[model samples]
Target: MKLFRIVHPLNGVQRLLLTVWVGAMWAIGYVAAPVLFAAIESRMQAGAIAGTLFSIVSWIGLLCGGLILLVQWRARHRGLSRVALSCIIAMLIITGVGQFGLQPMMADIKAQFPAGVEMSGELRSRFGALHGISSTLFLIASMLGALAVWRSAPTDL
Candidate 1:
């Protein structure tokens, strides 16, 4: 919407903030995906994936997040400009779908997990550890974005 550009402002600070937001989303997605995948892996209630879907999907999501940020930077550089940023923003809109879109789909997956299968406490904890590391990476990406913005970019024509 027009309100986002108006409110967020396309200055250095905003650009950095935008990058942080995107990065965090990716990190969290990776972390969460594994947790969900492990849970699904444990249940193995007939229809579960033979390999890891969430794991790959999560990695893809992370990659996409970085790519999208690059797209934003390119847009700022007057390459794609506002149109590029808008398209990237539209892509980010998919990121927001997680709060709603993903959870519902995952609920069905959770239900598919059979009760009797035993998943070790350590495995669950390890997944948590991965989540933590991935989350830290996410934060690091945000910090990098802020640094990139604050350091000054070449705006000369």
Candidate 2:
């Protein structure tokens, strides 16, 4: 007995892209970030590695989110399309704020402090606050991406 239905080729492609994008976000944000800190002896080195990885993830997110939006826009499923659109927009915004706005400020703070100097001052407080906000935004974006993936998955539809 046949147990599965064939979906449009575009649906498969879209789902694959979304899965990879969401998985990468989780891996980079949750896994790699912590690993870098644990493995690297220097805080600056760990931060640099994590920053580079996050920047790459942000760019990949933009491309994948844009592609998902384009495909969903042309799809016949209006409700799904709307949901995907909203989630993608939110993800994009969160990524922009985290990567463009917060990351740079944090980097600037790091630069202000001398090497081997513990960050203990107004700069440290600001950096810590921005880092918290950035982390929260990344988590939110990951959840929103997962939502888009769920809405786009192929099954009965």
Candidate 3:
């Protein structure tokens, strides 16, 4: 089809997008976040910085995922598998839930406390629970992203 023809040449671009997106997920989640916590004296400040990084990565995932999905959908007949498509969709959904759903709830909890102050009691428990869920979701998405990158190899199809 015309769409496939238009998108066919984007195979390399799609792979590049996937690499960047997944690489960022791994770097920020595993590397930078931990460093921020360990190096920064103020837990609140460290958390704020890590949260911002996560938010940026989430946005990147959404954009790259959208574009990759468009390319994959258009070129589906050319060798791109449904599994790859499904992985991207799953990643997008996870990112959306983290960004739109869980992050706001966590933010609201944080907002209840004074600046530079650590949360405690019921608020601390609630925030911790939400953070745990968000972290689990992020980990799942990162794993899926790794799988997707592997599957995108030229010979894998």
Candidate 4:
């Protein structure tokens, strides 16, 4: 009973964190990135801007996800569903793969080319493939975030 009293307030905090994290993911991936690509004249410039935004959002996810996991861990006995926890973990892993893995390879490929010179043939194909994988991973993470938020709700729990 005492623990419930302490953990109860954290429920609101957890919900807020989830909302912020998932909302950022949707806003950045679906809205802002596309707008940058369409509105900006230079593909390289647009990509750079979009990449920075993605990096920022990824860090936001890491922070929010870490805090949410800590809160869930603390309140584990309070009927928190394992599904929600699993979703968060999966989202984190996706974020990691996108950030640390695919992004670096793509960046390296980009670095190989000169400032205005575009990649050709094999390099272009490889970059395109990596970007596609990154985008797919981002989509999966966004969906998982939505699932986590839904499953972690007090009503659902």
TM-score for each of the candidates: 0.35, 0.84, 0.90, 0.89
Top of the candidates by TM-score: 3
**Candidate 2 Cα errors over 4 Å, as ranges:** 1-6, 74-81
Better of 1 and 2 by lDDT: 2
**lDDT agreement with native, every candidate:** 0.45, 0.81, 0.89, 0.86
Flag regions of model 1 displaced more than 4 Å. Answer: 1-10, 25-80, 114-154
Q: Model 3 Cα displacement at 147 (Å)? A: 0.4
lDDT of 1: 0.45
Using lDDT as the measure, name the better of candidate 3 and candidate 4. Answer: 3
Which stretch of 10 consecutive residues in model 4 shows the poorest summed lDDT? 1-10
Model 1 residue 49 CA deviation in Å: 18
Best first by lDDT, ranked:
3, 4, 2, 1
For model 1, how does the per-residue alpha-carbon lDDT over 1-157 read when each residue is reduced to its tens digit? 2433332233454455445554544444445545655777454442244214433444454455456566556556533335434544444444335323543444444444356653446554554454455445444444443444334332442
Q: List the residue pairs that clash in candidate 1.
A: none
**Each candidate: RMSD:** 11.8, 2.6, 4.6, 3.5
lDDT over C-alpha atoms for residue 104 of model 4:
91
By descending TM-score, how would the candidates be arranged?
A: 3, 4, 2, 1
